[model samples]
Target chain A: MPGVVVVGQVARDLVLVVDRVPEEGGSTDVRERQELLGGKGANQAVACRRLGAEVELLGVVGADRAGEDVLAQAAADGIGVGGVLRREGVPTALLVDVVGPPGVRRLLEDVAPAALLTAEDVRSRAGLLQDAGAVLVQLQQPGPAVVEALAAARGALVVADGAPADARTRRRVLDAADVVRADGSEAEALVGWAPRGVPETVRAARELLEQGPRVVALAAGDADVVAWADGHVVLPHLGEDPVDPTGAGDAFVGALAVALLRGEDPRTAAWWAAAVAAQVVGTAGGRPHLDPDRLRETVRRHRGA
Target chain B: MPGVVVVGQVARDLVLVVDRVPEEGGSTDVRERQELLGGKGANQAVACRRLGAEVELLGVVGADRAGEDVLAQAAADGIGVGGVLRREGVPTALLVDVVGPPGVRRLLEDVAPAALLTAEDVRSRAGLLQDAGAVLVQLQQPGPAVVEALAAARGALVVADGAPADARTRRRVLDAADVVRADGSEAEALVGWAPRGVPETVRAARELLEQGPRVVALAAGDADVVAWADGHVVLPHLGEDPVDPTGAGDAFVGALAVALLRGEDPRTAAWWAAAVAAQVVGTAGGRPHLDPDRLRETVRRHRGA
Candidate 1:
């Protein structure tokens, strides 16, 4: 049985890279196209699974051809899909990432209502969520589902990802979460506004740490700040310009969860998260392709520096 | 056998309608998603086929899954796929039409080099092209392929669609063509500039007529001018807003060819083309779902007016 559970979206990700975006009534050719299994939940689960964290995903995918395809991919990636629900009468979610001109990206998401986990689905997966050593909940889902997942994972190292859908879910999540991870906009949803600079982001991360989570990670402009009870660490952005940043955050949180599950302290785990995230943005698409040994070397090098 | 042969691209078309396009680093959910067989060649072929014309398509698609899927769709639509070349090693072409706001569309085309018809591929289909009653060539393809298609259709009602790639191909097409249809931008390439009003479009059409075509159609701001040896007719655009204008021109030219093949006079055929174009823009995506009887009625009403 997998020791970790990921409760979030499982979608078909299509990446179309073009040299430049054309104006309205104009056209541009796509230089690269990648169709893969992706979504924050699937990406994070794949990241954790790649690092040898036995992981099972809890999410809803519509009963369509793409659903079958993504499930086959998840199984091949060594993640358990038993907890995934195939809701009838809808097509699976689709995320199209149009990357143009260096790091510019536009996203088109098709997450239908039926493709999202309902409270009923989360309740039905209580056994899977409760038995996991750690459970990560994507708060972007419906409020009821987010709260249900938080409640189901009683003693697990519960991690909350993204901003809660509403204030009620926010309260419930903070009451139960052991770790929190949010990107810029989501951090703005948690704190009053988006923090700028390393010092301001450190203050913001510390503010989140006071709201129930033992460790809090928040993204600043080009760097990340991770704060805990005693101290904090500010990680610089990857040196090279990123090919695509669509899935970097998911990789970071997944690495952070895996490191914590392996008994690493908060400081070392944040370093691991940063190193893994840097590797992910160096490639394209939301799904992470991880090499554990290489990632370890990168983390060690960064830490020594 | 169908009497119409369309020579150009064969691609998988994806229409994603979003409420609004997101800014950089932002995301928007797709309001609707439509995936189908599309391309200038395939769209025109489908339109001709729907009007009871026996149509065969000559184009190149990659030897990929999308190729197989689009070919299956063409076959199901009663268009002959015998002349469609399946080149290995390259993925099938994809055209993504992102429709936002009313009538605003951004096209992302993935027409890889291998997905385009080579001169060899076009030449190989000489028998099919020669046997057709009308052959429509999309000039957006490589120059050699367009020239080969024009040369092969020596005795057919040669129709050139879109802008020719180079001066040589343009001269060859003008010399060989019996009919020419171009939208505003393509009209600019044929002439020196895009015609602004109906009268200017009429002059542009007459100028094209002197270049060899017996019938020439040129799009102006909101109307189309169809010129012949004696006089010209300016057809106003469809009254309602277009849902997506991605394939309206393809439908117009296809309907025109079908009407002329059925022995309708140039004036009545132009009316049919206008009526069909109006109906096509009422829907999203490039593939047209045409009703012959309904369109004939609409054309009769418009022609009588």
Candidate 2:
């Protein structure tokens, strides 16, 4: 099945559960620990695959144990790995998530391998990108690779998430993406002003639209607002208590990619994306356990609403 | 180089550096993170190999990516894996070390595959145990496997470290070992009384000697005291600042096993063990990088002292 292609970072996430943060020179006991597969691109790919979209991943993983583990997990999830590169003599990227109580998590990241991905790696997978129904890219990957990937997916629907750390990459992403999904903080960083409420978020999203994406979706507090040349739509909260919000944004982008590929209207697609985010935040880790039948049922229910 | 055979657990250690642990309902940020090879058995085996012993490991690792990584690390360190078992469907053991400032660390462990080790597995390698110069066992493994490994090492000098959590396994380990090593707290747990001073530690070591071991060494604060039927010896500290003391006890045990195989007297062997512990505590992680020549020079200097 031809599906959306995702290009970005892939990392091993170590989650440690602690009661509270200790002061300097003090120690706290870890209540629980788990190792999981994570990274923006990988999480979105897994989300798409779980929701029954034929998904392929384009990224680089080191020839280390963590890389091997990531590959094994991606394969188990049925995501296509034909575009994944295994680089030798490098360490795979890593993320350490220290979760305290509810909704409190501190992330420590090492993106060594992610930074090593080059434009050559993306250009080499030009065929895969062109064949994809839609291509999703997270700007957290190297700027050069993201640029090359965006160029390669010119013939396909390009959905971009995340603001690059630098102005050049941010402008490049805004210019290349058919759809851009950003949270309130990211929108502030990209558009130069923080959106306060739903009205302001739509205004901010329209400003982002001026930067070039055909559609701009900005996730504001308790609501998501999207703007395009035609008009704007405000999506209300799906009302699920999130176990973890780490992967919610990626889930939204992944589901949106699938919706657009299925020829849904932007308003309906944003609602579907919100549903996926709700399901994701209700689960542990970045990759939620998504059953395609249940997801379809939820979408059908939302359509009636 | 048919050297000491190490039988016990092998684990991947995820070390997280955090400020003081958070309180219940609180959160903290992690300062740093690392992944390293660990486990009582793996640490001791690596220590012996670094100290120039022809070391072989007898343990089980899951037939997963973590297991593959552990094997690669063991092979790179020149430790033998011929006796290592690859079990299907189980995860490799993992230890999460949440470290605060110096000497403040909390351990959260999962011994999944280690617990699956059985008596049958140990008996299968009886020939390797009997042919070894000495066999080192950590009671952290499954009780049945520990018992079988001890029985198989009857013809070789059996050095046992770590007290079993259960009374039955503790009795069995004490009965099977030629030399037993335990820290002051563990010695107290095994003997039913906490040793408060050097003299009490020696008395506790002698009580442990009466149980079955030919010699018992109890590591107390600042000194190590060993007791045997004839008499006892107190070894002074090598006087080094320990960077992390997580594996110092294992280093002492591994080095002492090597020394006994070389026919050194218990007093001299304990001194050598002290030197090894000093080197280990001065390094990071459980496995210290030891140069055989440097280790020998330090041992020689200790003897002269």
Best by TM-score: 1
For this target, which candidate reaches the highest DockQ against the unseen true structure? 1
Evaluate residue A70 in candidate 1 and report its C-alpha lDDT on the 0 to 100 scale: 93
Where is the poorest 10-residue window by lDDT in model 2 chain A?
Answer: A21-30
Candidate lDDT (C-alpha), each: 0.87, 0.79
Who wins the lDDT comparison? 1
Candidate 1 regions exceeding 4 Å error are A188-204, A286-288, A291-305, B188-200, B286-288, B291-304
Q: Model 1: per-residue lDDT, tens digit, A1-305?
A: 24999999999999999887778777887888998889999999998988789999999888877899999999999999999999888898999999877677889999888888899999998999889999999988899999999999978999999988888888888889999988887887776578877788898888877878999999888888888999998888753678888888998999899889888899999998988888888787856567778777887787885
Backbone clashes, candidate 1: 1
Identify the CAPRI category of the predicted complex in candidate 2.
incorrect
Q: What is the lDDT of residue A44 in candidate 1?
A: 93
